[model samples]
Target: MPTDVTYPILNAQRATELLEIAKSYDNDTAFPAAELKEIGVLLSQVIGDDKFVGSAEDVAPTADLLNAFMLLLICQEPTSPAAAQSALHIASLGALAGNPAITSRGFRLASRYYDALQDSEKAWAYAKKAAQAGDDAQLIKLQNIAEQKRAAEEALAAQQAQAAEAEETAELEPEEPEERERTGTLEEQLNELRDRLEIAKRENVKEHSEEFVDINRQVQLAAFSEEDSLPASPVGVAPNPSTALAKALSILLESAVGALWACPSFATRSHVANKSNEILRKYHLSPEYATLPAGMLARFYADAAGNNTDTTGETAADFYGLAAKEYSRSGNEARELEMLLRKVEVFLIDNDRDEAHDILASRYVNALKYTELPIAARWTVLFSETLRTEAENMFKSTQVLMDFLGRHPIASARSPLDFNALAEVFELLGDRYTSANDAVTAREKYRVAYELFNTANNQEALAALAKKA
Candidate 1:
């Protein structure tokens, strides 16, 4: 009896030793089915938390172990999908516990189980997780599966519908022989006519659609067809050459006046006006020539003499007034006002502050009296105010400046000067709020200052808080 018990113990020990050897081989190349089953039975018996099954680091042959365990679990008589899934899940967790490379393998196993069970939602969930975990292969596989499933469903529905129609047609066939044939023929003709009518209706609807305009435009392109022709220009005699030349010269003079008025750069303005006069002379027309047709002459000039001389403020203002009168005579009120504004701008640029202010104030007040012109006139007033504010920092009231900053936060937030101003205001507000010990208001002011500093990309200030922390 002692010998028999010793033999059984020795055999069990030998079997375990062989199992370990087989596992080593499986780890390197292939896992033998018989050996894995034997090892699984042994593992099921003695495996416990305290058995020193070894750490993940010790399990260098993790892939083999996982595969072997999965095979053993799946080969059970009443193989439970849930059990297989759980085994795969646990194995995957073990594989990915410390190894990022093996993480995708775990996710892939989970996906496979979910897919095998036809649980598409769970499969997609695993697939998305795997994709996020950096598994390109699994992501592509899941996408393909989804596309194929959709295509299959669509095809199946179409086939079923076709089959049902065929069956209906067959059932109605026998009743349509003699009298039915006559009626059926008429019906067939009518149906054919209806189909044609439907097609015509659809074509008409499509023709009237916005898409037709685009299609027509495309077909009309010269590049698309060699036979395409350009549209004819309107036929009219050229304007009297002298008059055309004079009008062009006048337009150029007006542009120069506008330029000088807007920015009071004398040399540039005189140069432009002189060039216009030269072009008029070259084309045989005078500066004061009337009855000039506008279209015959080009609106620009290249070169002219006498531009080097300095232009006085009065000269600029006079020229601008004359240009406005010429445009007004031609019924071009928009151009006339534009020229007037240019003159005002030139005056402002020339440091003729009183004249510039007078012009703007008079025009603005007059415009307000005309209710019909109020909206456009209001825009001009606003533009004038903006220009004035831009000219002199001393003219800007503190409240007005702050309101401007509030309205144009992006512009105000851009420059260091604006940021400094903002910070100063916040600091002052913070002091006022804190003197009364209003913590919330004080904190809000500080927060605004901090945000402004950050917006201005002051990294040093941002890091200062962290250092204190």
Candidate 2:
């Protein structure tokens, strides 16, 4: 029912105003059905297509508010068809855009929508989503429903199979012992099985429904996941999180440290990093304390997070130095390696890749001294990030990086070394070779990566298609 039409994209201030208007909307002060419909369409259009990003700091907030508006609309008119459709559209937008918060809220509304429609399967599906979003009651209800559904389906299948087997046995029974009356004839039994099959298929409409909302057109527009990746605060300084130091770190991590470095203002980043470290230090000084840098980090990809502490004129190297010492005191070698990686990354960021790459080479050998297997593969990725094919006199460093990973750790695919990280290293090397216009070498690097992860979904084909630059 919605049509394509570009209205002037509103700014953050205007988005806020619209949110207030939506919040205040009720039957008495009704925003016309037409206006609400158009807003709904635009909300899906902008975010689904990924065209909503803008230079204004309000961009992310505006997107969030648009989702909030739809939630408010559904809350106001819980029984309306239009409101149900609105909720579905918002859920679809969240799915396509991959916004977990919006997805959670959308599914909550959708559960009620499907329940009102008497579509039990869909109602349960949406209910399950809401439960996953942290609804305890719904989770209990969903589990019970799932058990019931599974048992019903299994029973139905067994009945059908028994009917088929009985039909087969009847054919081989030599006229049922001379004039024996047939009990539930094969034709009648088969018909009964068919009826049950139809019923089963009908109940399965949630997974097989013909009704669908196409979002591919909009998905194509979102060339990157940048908006989801980098969520900005307000126009000025973002507030320091009010929670405890540990909780605050978790909150920041939710937005991601990568996104924090991507913020528009260096000063804001400085403030955040400085505040976080200050809290970390405070905890260390306290009797009961928590650390910000505590995590398994999923395999070999060391946390070489960009030291956004650069704006304060104090380098990330200094931070990593302090971390490395603390980790050393605790005898945490893995963490020490991670902190040392930050040190190497600082050199790369400062455009001195050779220095860090060389230092890492020695560390790689030293690491082998303590390991059961000679697996220095993770550091190869650390070395590869700083390679500049364009630079002169860096041939030795590049050679060292290549030689180290070529041995290829004999670890399982499930090894502690992040296979994905190693694959990334291979891809990056291919990219470097591609940039240098050495297509032959680029293809070789890609092929090596292919051999590392030889699954059906492997990027081997895409890697093979790299053209000379």
Candidate 3:
């Protein structure tokens, strides 16, 4: 029933500020816990204002994300069963919205909650779900925590049972004074030490566990995938009224594609992506849409490619191939090259290095010869980063990076390049030099990286490498 005006305004900038506030909380540091909880309650009102199923689609995803964080803030302790239940509800919303990060957090929070309640089975199940949804690190952490909790609980229960048995046996047949005196004090001390050890172990687990993995920026990236490659609206001729239903369906498909691609568990959500592709294919094959622009079909294939989640990237590669052919047919050479680059990226993600390298060496080289500087620069950066991080060939990585810098100076790229990305490249260059024992050159690279991070006002990255600089 809520109108757009009635919905709470949680835009991207506001969302970023909220995420920073959540990340600032440290168990070791003093923070405004009560104030944050108060904010959470208000946000919860917005998230639960309607059955999330009926909430405004765009606002709901962000609101649910914030609500998950807020719930974590309030439910820091295991005793807050109610808050934990709320987290499960928020997680269900994540499933509905197809957001893996939010879903993973929600399930992990519930796992902690159930673990606190000594429900190991439920905790384990939720933890597994969290892992399946892309928070792979949480699964191991939760398992360790759960094992510790269960052991402590079992020890306490055994201690109580033994005490009761001893009391009953004493009523029937008392122990000798000398025997009791010899064992009583030592037994009590051992029990006390065991209790202290369990408490300390639990504390250690809590200390290592992060409140939430930072994923706000990742969600933003997924939400806007492929936005740059396509035209703002449909190109060529507009659809006639006779094809109105198919056009409406196509619009719906595009929205669904974006939502599904934003999910970190896009692989599990592939069924939805598959169905959307089927619907688009139906429209494309219809005689009523025989006049549909190849550019429009290309856009559909390109967007669909982003949502594809096959493990080997074969299906996604095919979609990109189809999109490239369509773009070529439409005479959009830039878009065709974009699709080819995307195909390379897909292979890179799948770690099909040979395939990715072949494409880069073959089709990409020929395509790059005719592309603009910015497009060519993007491919170079991608290849260099993959070599540095994924392949772990620091020498080759450095060579490629230096060559890129030589050709595309930072000054020339100030308008087009992402400062954080450029700063990271410099940071990696510093790391490469540091590994080679060239301290002087390394320091030079770090200094440039530091300056770039400063210019970008990226305080966290700056702090991380400040000592190196």
Candidate 4:
């Protein structure tokens, strides 16, 4: 069949082959732009003819192929303005063939080219079209640029009006000599009053500064006294007499033994010292009672000294010290050790690792003594073992969980379960499993854990875990 060859119409077969080739080379950097452009030109030419009308019914697929070809050409010749414009034109044609993304991209490319050429009106027009095509970000940027230009113009007009008003005012300003003299007199009087006010302010500040300095010095002295005088008590012991007296001296010292387990303020310290002195005046103070554990009497002295001050000067060490004392005083050794473990946790949070280790060691030794106490004894052993394991592992995996939760706080907030923490644990486990070449088990475990995480309503984590699995 020597048919009429007036136009080159790529029939269905040739079109399919071209489409396959275009798809294959679409994302390949090694693909030639000339080849992709040729394909686009041939497709365009075929599309314009009535011969390929029936085949063009598969327009969506052809459009995708054409879009891919245009994208490849653009990528290869990105710096060439002519190539960019051609790609944009092809994308627009492909859009008619049912490719909305291609249409949106075409608008974006047109806007970018117009912007580079400094054609604001054209750039704005294309940007608006892109926005209409679902490019919200580009639309917002263009709107902001238009708004900025409008604001600049308004500002310039306002400045011109202001200058005109100033010139008019200056022309009229010299007409009233007596009024100007009166205004000058009022201004001078205002300046004189300001000078006096400044002098008074300086004097007031100087007086207040001296008072503040004295108060600060007293606070420091009280802090030092409390620190030096307090004797170290094992976890759960009540403060001894010397510690009580030292605590009594510091207006800033709060009793770790108090209900709130906090320190007293400087004001309270003064009141208590006065009350103690008054008590001494009423009777003969025995020197031996000074060494005795002051008990309720020490607290009363501090209370009187605080004078109902609201400030509680409790530091982290004071809280840990108090917790330790409370634990030591407990009747049940197992419960006491558990409480001491909590104190160790507090010490760790405070970054006092040495103190934490000391508490752990002491509690571990004491827990061994409570082996006779059934449930409590069992708990003691479990807690001790847990603590030892955590220490040995350096809590690295737990730390990873904490960090993950911190970063993806919204995921934690939305989920009933701690998805971020669980995901992190699974991630670490997956890595370990993969390293050991247990792919089958790792895959199953990862899938199950990922499902759990997915159920926790964290899509991003689920996606990440799914990818890993």
Candidate 5:
């Protein structure tokens, strides 16, 4: 039944004829190949089409005609992917024109198709839409199930809220849980990530809480004479009684002076510098009493005028290098990684995610093994920033990066990747293949993504991919 597509697709009579033939399929259960071609041509014509500016010469199919196609599709191949896809496109055309009939049938078709695939979440979505169109009993029943699921989800949310409140209020040790030592299989880790990625996307990871940022900012950085983060004393302090005593004295002085003098006063700059220098110099004279103190200050400026705004990003980049230095020097890997992550966070704020990623990808790849929930969460934030921001340019490499991250390795813990995040990754991969015209690979990715979460927006993409086979 394939027509000579050489018949000008833009010809008004051609569209009208195809619409008439499609609607009169009283005997057929499936559309003939020619009719499918006509339908496809219409879809192609409408892709990125300018909105209909109704005038005397408007040749496009009307809303009523689109609605008729929806009904025709439902009757012809209600459960087929192709028909559902066709219905989705045609129904959208009607909905744009505020046609109730087309909208109703479209939802009904979608609900039926998803239900056939045994995907309750998606089926429930369209069924709710169908019910909203009118008071259909079947639609109402399906809507009720969707409502019950929503209620259950809400209840789960409340429980999680309560648990979070408890955790926040609890007096807890800073160490990770004992179960963190157990790392599971790759499959298990992938499943964990799949679920996590879904939820993260649902909540929109782009807009997550900066709880770690606040924590890092508020943390008192360990001040050792060897720690380059703070202006250190010349003699490095070791784990000795005298060194410990010196560390204690330094902490006391920092709380009293260093913390207070975070913002250097112009009038007192020279005085404080002289005092600090003399204090450190005294350590050389009196070897027993080291004067290095606890540090909680960000000494950004070299002079009181604060002339260096770090406009070239060298200063930010140096912080990353110092963090690396601290990481190599400290035996406590967790603390050092946290300190490094804080620097990366600042890099992100400075709109330097590329630098942040480079530091993380190269210097801190080992941090991925960190089993602490808080630490894993930090990596998740970092990955989210880098992967999402660089997604368009580095999609292939982004996939490799995320894949290498594997799991958080915390026992019975959620994945580092949120469910939506993974779905998005796959979706993006699908797009990459599609752009390359690798239909087979693109369709496989699309199907997996669609199965993970059925989105109305991906309908045409899924359809287009399916048609290639």
Candidate 6:
């Protein structure tokens, strides 16, 4: 395996020239064969050396140069597999450097290469990555390209399937063949998007993950809606004044939080946070926007709690509680539970064991009673383990453990609990009993823990437990 090594930063003049070359040209623009080979050699030397220093500013120019070489290679030989591989390598470099611009450019090329290979899903995934790296325009272009490709493929399939019928109809009519319609008109497209968004909202789809990429795509597309026919709101949801205002607000809130993260001085962060809070407060009452601002405020307060000298965590708990309530109002039980867990974590960090225990236990019992086992089980395990480590009453910890075991038997294959984690829990229980000088219970727990460790194929843990025994 090749290891990365640090190199001296590139010269500023050379870096600028490389970026200019990379960004100025498109696939149609050709490079001289000699110039392409020269760039290829330069790229090979940089990559072959594997000297991608941690500084993105230093490595960015090189990444741009590599991507430029890829573009030139593609321009010259569109069929070359090497061009695709080169773009992929540049993307990896971009990830290592944490350069979004470079990553987006690399992903754009990779998307195009995969699209040309008829790998629609892979192409779409790359395009999605590009969009996330702040290249929304590229995502739209790629979507249109993929849609056109799908339409063409369907047209071809229809022609093949109806060849006989088409021949008979052609002989009967003897008319000119009409051009295939590419896409719907503006109004029809808006209606289609609105319908899809309504369906997604009705289904209560999880928008955070890629499980429903179309939701994100539709949201992003809606951001670009023209004023006259703004399909801004989903079905049964209150609309913003316009789609632009909603998009702008989202951007401003995100930018404000981002600036807070980058600010070194606590005073500056507080200033930014206060300003962000003002913006959030203005729209927080709006049903359409309430959930987001509440979550953002929770994040802000959580950060402040971590950095602030006061360790009480009182302020953070209040914000997280508000976030939980907002999530509940939005009917997002998962996020609400997550915020509750965050509250528990904040209290735990402050060493307020009683507060953490009460909050977590109260919520966990209620959730387990109402929520699905698969959903609640993980949270239950987390809460129990947290209490086991931090709670004052060891017996209560043991009871929670026994409760978990009774509900989700470890021996069962259908159980969602992790075997290694269960082994660790048992090991901790054995230690607690040993500390209490209960030889019989300690030995029994140790045996159970040893078995679980062995079952999990955890050789190190088994050795440690055997040594203790």
Write down the lDDT that model 5 would get: 0.46
- Candidate 6 regions off by >4 Å? 1-247, 253-278, 281-323, 346-350, 367-395, 412-417, 451-469
Best-to-worst ranking by TM-score:
3, 6, 5, 4, 2, 1
Each model's C-alpha lDDT?
Answer: 0.44, 0.47, 0.58, 0.45, 0.46, 0.58
Candidate 1 on 1-469: residue-level lDDT in tens?
1212221211344454543654355245654667666655544433344231434432324433444455444444224564345435444544445554455655666676667777878776776666556553555566556556766896678657655644554454322112112234323433443343344335544343222222222222211123522222123434342332332333333333333333233333444455444434443333334344332121222111112242334445554655555566666555555556656654554466566656554564333333222233332434345444554422232333344335445343546645644544554444345444564665676677666666656665444322111
**What's each prediction's TM-score?**
0.27, 0.30, 0.37, 0.31, 0.32, 0.35
Please state the error at residue 322 of candidate 6 in Å.
5.5
Q: Model 3: clashing residue pairs? A: none
lDDT of 5 by residue, 174-271 (tens): 32212222246433433443344344335633342222111111212222224322333345544333443344334323322331233232223223
**lDDT tens readout by residue for model 2, 354-463:** 66666565576655344322134456555555444323434653665566556544253464234554555565576566555565777687676665545324454333
Task: Give per-residue CA lDDT, model 4, range 146-221, as digits (tens).
Answer: 5567668866796576556545544543211121122333234334333433453355443433222233233333
Which residue pairs in model 5 clash with each other?
196-418, 196-419, 197-417, 197-418, 197-419, 197-420, 198-418, 198-419, 198-420, 250-293
Q: Per-residue alpha-carbon lDDT of model 3 for 1-469, expressed as tens digits?
A: 3445544445545555555666566667666565466556545555554455244444444544455464455546646655676668657767776778778878887776777677878887888888788664455565445456666896679657656654554454421112111233323433433343344334543342111011111211222224411112343456553343433343334334333434343332344456556645555544434444668668767866755434456777878977888898899988888788888776554466656655554554545466665566556656666666566776776786677567556775463235665677787777677767675787799898898788878896776676355
Could you tell me which residue pairs clash in candidate 6?
none
Ranking of all candidate structures by their lDDT, best first: 6, 3, 2, 5, 4, 1
- Which of candidates 1 and 5 reaches a greater lDDT? 5
Winning candidate number (TM-score) = 3
